[model samples]
Target chain A: MGKALAAAIGLASIAAAVTAPTAFGQPPPGAAACSGCHPASARVTSPVVRLAGLERDAIVRAMQGFRSGQRAGTVMDRIAKGFTDDEIQALAAWFAAQPKGGEEGNPARVPLPKGGEEGNPARVPLPKK
Target chain B: MTFTRRRFLGLAGCTALFPAPARGQGAGPRVVVVGGGFGGASCARALRQLDPRVSVTLVEASATFTACPFSNAVIGGLRELSAQQFTYARVAADGITLVPAMATAVDPAAKSVTLADGTRLPYDRLVLAPGIDIRWGALPGYDEAAAALMPHAWKAGEQTLLLRRQLEAMNDGGLVVIAAPANPFRCPPGPYERASLIAHYLKTKKPKSKLIVLDAKDAFSKQRLFQAAWAELYPGLLEWVPLSKGGAVTSVDAATRTLVTDFGKHQANVASVIPPQKAGRIAEAAGVTDRTGWCPIDPVTFESTLQRGIHVVGDAAIAGAMPKSAFAANSQAKSCAAAVVTLLAGGTPAAPKLINTCYSLVAPDYGISVAGVYAPSGGQLADVPGAGGVSPANAPRATRAAEAVLAEAWFHTITGEVFG
Candidate 1:
């Protein structure tokens, strides 16, 4: 029984890692930073330029331009000063991988406990608007 | 007690029906957030989004939230007060329990908050985002009574309306004085933006009227961009007096509509003396704030270093490099919510990355901004080495015009995200 429990724990750990690649099962690193201003996809209310679904290289180029002062931006140049080439690349890749409409808000931080998923009668559902 | 297949199956069914708690972890962790501003509201929503099992209750004193991000535009008459207002219908629909009551006290040991009516709401984790409260007497003779006469207009809502009315009622050539506070205030660039917007209003409506900024600090956020815009647009109409130039206002006589600075007493048709500020009273009551009058927290989790299981975000926390801006608060709230969810599941929190973009509208057609990306390192949030900056100095009209549109869009989208 003890050995079986250990094996289940090991598999669950791997599953969690596979399901949640980012730290803390939250949005990809740097996603929240863009959320408030750019969001994902495009909206009439969105002010900043959208980056989701953009080619990785294009995003990298814009970030590099801002970093090097070649790009004229409201606050991008200053903001770009905070990232390295590698971090910028990572951010670019993450955003590019996202769906056009953005991730469904943010994912659950931890996997649902056994028997507590959507269909579970015990689960407290969101209120209807 | 003997282990048998039939007995084991029966016990397993019982365990499945009533699951054991995760070691020492509590069952269905409840998170309570106080104050529904950018930080608290975002945290509450993110908490629900991050873990449906983790119950979230949001305690807000006001029925409707008034966003400070664009309240300056409202004060400048660029936008209406209604535009800055928002309801919590969406946030509630997202599964967070909305408690429309003021949190009067926090008991850390019990993990509960006593509301104004003395209802105790318990929680496994508490996020306090009670934003800045003005140090009313910090500016001499500037108390609640004086604020009624000379509106600070800092908190938005009624104060914003008061200032707007004062601006409209003033005569064409009357002088308007705006007394700006020192560093580490909410929206570091706000006073200057207000000045720019007020100047825009004056230029179009009352060109002869002049506005002066009596600043406590010698420097300001986005100084060069604002100065450049002021020079090109309303050159002589707007003037800024730095602290070294005797611009520091020491006191005000609201009855006489006069401000006393190091230089001398200056009278104006209207005055706005933005007072110095500190973390909201609830933070101190919760024992999260320290000698600096701001809460200190773990940079990654935003958990108050002073109190375990309690997190602080937004203007109240001494966020190392991040300014107390709405975007910063929203970003921190997301990260903090993640941390709370992780801890509730008996897991360690990972490092967090945050971003802040603050845009200031100098005119209806012009906007400028400062932005930065931050990460928790060396126990503090430090800006990424090469990631953020301000809008170019003396940029072309098109760029500023585009930024203006972006600023509006940002305001709309962020408010929607926070409230919708």
Candidate 2:
């Protein structure tokens, strides 16, 4: 094998070594509460739109859009589609209680609108394409 | 230029805030990092990036990292494996002594980690970011040999290739069965993406072929987005059997290449089973893992609560409120690296912030994702509420494809953070 290939293989074994037998930590207390409604942790924070200040009404609409093919992540969208209006609010309430994304957001850096502030209740009004 | 008294005072104030490792502590101390995937690589790279004086040794079992992040795209035919693969070339250039060895034993009390070849390396601190391993027998007849017959392809390398080959060679009307494992595995959206990609290929090449998903759970990550796209794009070509409908495969007889599920026995032209997983072996060997088969750590510093002088990240450590995704591993790894460096430097580690964004493609141009902000709290890191949520539903194809593009960029950004 070439030196590079040999080096690569060597690294793979070490990776295999570290991951010898573990998968992940146990789900937290509320994880089951969330999983019953959604499979994975649906609310993940990134440098994009903030999950804080999310309105239940808006969340429900978005979930409906996703479920109906007006949204994306077909899997998640469909799951959202199945939610009753009440469940959407529960999801919104659950995620809204979490903290804002740790990363700074520059919506203009890519696509979407400027994010909302902590108490400002910045609703991401559907983009006015 | 020589530092003036006034300038010296300004720099000194800053140093006091984030005190550098007391230099001439004789090349500081050595930090041995295991695993070259996102978590390990990020920790190793970050250690060197932040501290110029620390002597860092990174021992990895593989030379090339086939990232699970982009490997999904490769299976979708959007990219090749080479596009997702990386070498330690850049990390090695960063003044880190990259070792090609597997850590077989970790003597935390002695602060030394032993490799498979019996090479004992000592460290002031040891960082273990080992990923995961399949419970080979969790599903009956799913031993190492039998796995070859029905590839799990969970690791994102050869199995990915093998799974791809079988899919490519399958006939138009052939049946492709994807048996998804239970919760808490590597990459929540992974299995869904695999189904979507396979469907993409079938829709184009063999429109009549079937892509069937047998899921242990009724719901999966990004379910809405996946289903929406499937109905709109690959309708009648994809069928999902939930656990209630005998989706869970209890066992498989590789000799006959048949899968026996809770419902009944089924034969398919191709079968892929994602087995249940657990923390890597070394964590168990080091006594860091608990009875649950994963290492329990103080979520703040990601230090093993069960063992001193040892930190576990990635799929090995039980990190609450975070999906076992690549981004979470990288974030947790970076924070762990920071904390280890701080403690070794004789300073209190600062609060760490963990961030993650896991994107999944439902079809060739359709993608969705979930993002979150997390921080160590009390004794664990919990997800920030309303900070992030899954992708909106029924988005335009442009937006869906935009997610796919963004996922690739995020993959590049993270891998660069770890090993680039």
Candidate 3:
């Protein structure tokens, strides 16, 4: 089902790409919200797909597919329906400019503490049953 | 820069005769943010990212922030409390001055905040991300003292452990009761998620035990999905009572672990009463909250409608269509930060695009979600037509498993972005 939907949306994008206009400027109004789920860096291990550095056309196509119910998604379909074509184009342009991969020695990256490990004092011990 | 009389007059209920302190030559505008949860921390970082010139200071009472999102997993015995805790060490390293002190008062007329230790910090723009504070005594017999006996694990710290311990210590056939509150509460789906996880624990550890949810609301977020999951995954072990069926808890007796409704009184061996909530006390002291006990704000910029030069995000804000969730708070903080930056630069902020997506787990591998995309419409936030809804009912287990993975990923990515 997923493959068939992707192929169908692929064909639809080819036709839409011919008329799509390039959008650029300060990041559009809603662009920052996407990073809540889609990580900015490739090194961030997330099941949600990363959006940085993707082809603008690809982002536009995926959004259109989600909006039109041609693509299967848990939440993206609902979110995609909220954006207009212009807004999507603007967001696509902004995300395409970001780095697709993580910086090697980025001091900003902080490792998250692992959950459920035994013998770690920070982990709250389970009550004796 | 001179303080303008017009700006002074714009401040509501101001009686101060003194002017705001002048900045040094070529100094950037100063911004003060209170509370270091998802909202304030995100805004503090976003401000530095948007404009390096703005001098930002964050005032938080605690050295570490305990996130409420995954704290439920801790209560359910699936995760650890340490995983939900984060420090602002990296946030401070990102050019923000961290003031580790409690904000005791806010003088809007003077545009300064007074800390508990007699320190006053002034700012050109102030952001209050004070999350919800339980309205003790609103429901008779449910107060701070009662919380010690019947824990309300809503704030996600010691209370979380208290409730977890109670559940673990109960005998095999003990009855567990969760009293859920009415509308406009933080994490609309939280009580249900807690119920689901606790039910999972009871089923595994104490097969003879039973759990009951007495909800104040007749309907709830992700109702269809949650009810379906409960029926399938925990048939005889759990029961949910809605408002129409006498679920609204009017009062409680902590000493007896008894919850009273209009219809009858129910007693339990382990009780979790999530009392009614209001905007954090700091918001009230700041004079930004309305009669609804929540702060009203301009949907586009999240600036408090009741007080100029102050913005309120997170659970405290009266966001029209947005539920009080960590994801929504993070989104609002970023937008508010961008607007504050623009205003400081003497430019108009563009209309904001706000979004919220909340993921809840019924079991370790069974997850569900609800999402919405909102924009300012008719002077308030409204959901765009044809957009946003919950996960489909009766989905294949693979779909649920996939969402469960994504839910964990969401936690990692968001916490990393704000704190890491």
| Model number with the top DockQ | 3
The alpha-carbon interface RMSD of model 3 comes to 8.3
lDDT string, candidate 2, B1-420, tens digits: 244434533543343344345643345567888888878887786787656656789989887777787676666566666656777877887788899988899887677889898989887677888799888898999988877768888888867766666676667788888889888888888888888888888888888889788888989887887888889988999898899999998988876668888789877777788889988887888889888888888865677888766789888888887788887887777678766666665554544545666888777567788876555554566554335577777567888888876665565455544544
Q: What share of the true interface contacts does each candidate keep?
A: 0.45, 0.00, 0.46
> Best candidate, TM-score-wise?
3
**CA lDDT, candidate 2, residue B28:** 54
- Name the lDDT value of residue B251 in candidate 1: 92
Query: Each model's C-alpha lDDT?
Result: 0.80, 0.68, 0.83
Ranking by DockQ: 3, 1, 2
Once model 3 is optimally superposed onto the true structure by TM-score, how far is the C-alpha of residue A109 displaced, in angstroms?
11
* Candidate 2 lDDT score at position B17: 42
**What is the alpha-carbon lDDT for the whole of candidate 3?**
0.83
Error of 2 at A81 (Å): 23
Better of 2 and 3 by TM-score: 3
| Chain B TM-score against the true chain B, candidate 1 | 0.94
Whichever of 1 and 2 has more DockQ, that candidate is: 1
Candidate 2 vs 3: which has more DockQ: 3
Deviating ranges (above 4 Å) for candidate 2: A1-129, B1-26
- Pitting candidate 1 against candidate 3, the one with the higher lDDT is 3
Q: Give the candidate order by descending lDDT.
A: 3, 1, 2
